[model samples]
Target: MPNSTSILSPIDVERIRKEFPILHQQVNGRDLVYFDNAATSQKPAYVIQALTDYYQGYNANIHRGIHTLAERATKAYEATRLTAQQFINAASEQEIIFTRGVTESINLVASSYGRAFLREGDEIILSGLEHHSNIVPWQMVAAEKKAILKIIPVTDEGELDLDGYKKLLTSKTKIIAVNHASNSLGTINPVKEIIQLAHQLGAVVLIDGAQAGAHLPIDVQKMDCDFYCLSSHKMYGPTGTGILYGKKELLEKMPPYQGGGEMIKEVTFEKTTYNDLPYKFEAGTPNIADVIAFKFAMDFITELGKENIAAHEHDLLLYATQQILKLPAVKLVGTATQKVSVLSFRVEGIHHFDIGQMLDARGIAVRTGHHCTQPLMDRYGIEGTVRASFSVYNTKAEIDQLIEGLERIINFMK
Candidate 1:
């Protein structure tokens, strides 16, 4: 069963904000109103404490030493793997392979799985809404293997064209990769339906859950996606650490992504054998401190409740969307009925960069660029958008600050 409560209590946004130390600071001589959560979230006190505790308590290399510090460190690190397995509801901890974030996770699959399976004339399906991490890796594989790349179209409203997706499937299609929720547009693609359709055509699916990991309830088993990826920093954890979850059978068959250290069972000049499941993919020392601290990040979301977080963020999205649309010549980029708390838009005759700068001066931080989805920006015939993404700690008061900031920018610049 999913982690939710029948009795949905309203989120105490003020109390939640208190957990984040960064929220208490002043940026540009004004109270910080952080809406750039889609890029990375501000860490809470406990999460930071987790890092300090690990280094101060038991900082040692894992899985090799018989010493006490090594055992303690190893236990904490592997415990996070199990926590992540339950966080996303992966079938087993063996399926969770820690990596350098979503970019490296996708590259791991494209390099290992693509090398093992993808062949000449095979087709790989992707979406127009995918982040460049999802796009460029497969593009490299397609180019190398002489395979073809197909895209599921996006509508003017920024929703995926399900009908367009159906039209693209063929026997030659070997793989399909898409984001669980688009980072740029916050369009929640019908991932389960997409996975089912791809399965019927005998193609495996990979869902980039970098954005969804923080905002949405994810069950890899329920979604039945062949692979999933996450960025720890996007979920309020430390940077340089993330997860790549694949089915045990699939991971068993795929070759190791990197060599040396814990990834190998035994090594010699004559021959080398890989370790089992996750260890096979996790190379080198791994992001030990961040991985240990990530447990607190997982605990933070779980303790607050995923449904509660979604509810709070949804309210922020609605309020921000309503207030921003009331401004002159302002157009919302994505109008997807089903979305998380990401609000991306642009005012007519104002460059997105200028809007970003003006808002920053008001102590309102937001993401302004293609949001690593340049192709998605190109689809709308715009250079980029001003993206204000919300999180559980955000409040309606912050949204008002954003609205006021935008209103002043439009009025002064025009």
Candidate 2:
């Protein structure tokens, strides 16, 4: 549970800073300034230690094991599911299905629920700002089911065109999928409104929360979304571990996502009865250690409180934006009023790749390019932009270094 604290309470930045060991290191003879939080966050010492403890102590397969070590491992692994349930305010642990990441989570839904529920000529709506993970899965499923794929357009400010979305919704719409926050633009979509609208059109909604999971406070029930996906790596946990939350009734109707040991109740040449809610989606041996360690990552966020973390990151965003905007050649991308800590931009007369490379030489890491939102890049008529995303561990001092580096790059290029 999150501590009872004021949202504006000052964060113990130094204490929190100590939790992340990687932040103390140096790169290229300069202090490492990690601004690639949109890609993946640096894991805290507790999370790292948790991973070490799991492998060093109870390195065993989870579930269906009778030994003491197995029981301990299973207990820890299942505990993460409970933590995840609480983290998202989910109805029950049964509603949470573990996967490799958001990509796999979306793919699972596209292959299973999509195959079962969608029919020929049924339409699946995606937004123009969707990551390839959200787009590709729907495309694959739509093609397989002979369904139509529709898109919700974006405005110049990078906000979703709700009017366009409303026009696209119809009786033929079976699924409406969109990201909670744009990875490239940091545009926060009105998912609750979108979900309600989709429900009115008799369509299910899936929110790709890959970017929003760590930064936003999410409640599946409040949002009324049929499905929500999260990537643990983006949230300061290990890679290759994520979650898919689906409504119980909807999950019960969908078939198992994969065929393997734990997903089965009874197996025979004649037929195989599938296991219950979560196990139905989790096939084969799962990433036990990482899943077990993810609880610490969740705990880290809970301890800080999501609102406090968001407020601090918001300060960083505003400061960075104000500083970057003063630069003569810098052009800010994604001017949406509602956004997370992502600040994407491009400098005049300088390629994004060149900016990124020069920044890397100064030990500042920022992502460059389309950020897996090719459609969005196409919409903006730019090849790519340099993206500097923030996390709870980041500081304004680092942003100062970033600004300095960008200024140097711009002047040198000019």
Model 1 C-alpha lDDT per residue in residues 278-350, reported as the tens digit of each score: 8999889989999998989988888778888898899889998889989999999999999988999988999
User: Candidate 2: which stretches are off by over 4 Å?
Assistant: 1-6
Residues 114-159, candidate 2: write the lDDT tens digits: 9999999999999999999999999999999999999999999999
Clash numbers, per candidate: 0, 0
lDDT values for all models = 0.93, 0.93
**Candidate 2: how many backbone clashes?**
0
- State the lDDT at 185 in candidate 2: 90
- Estimate the overall C-alpha local distance difference test score of candidate 1: 0.93
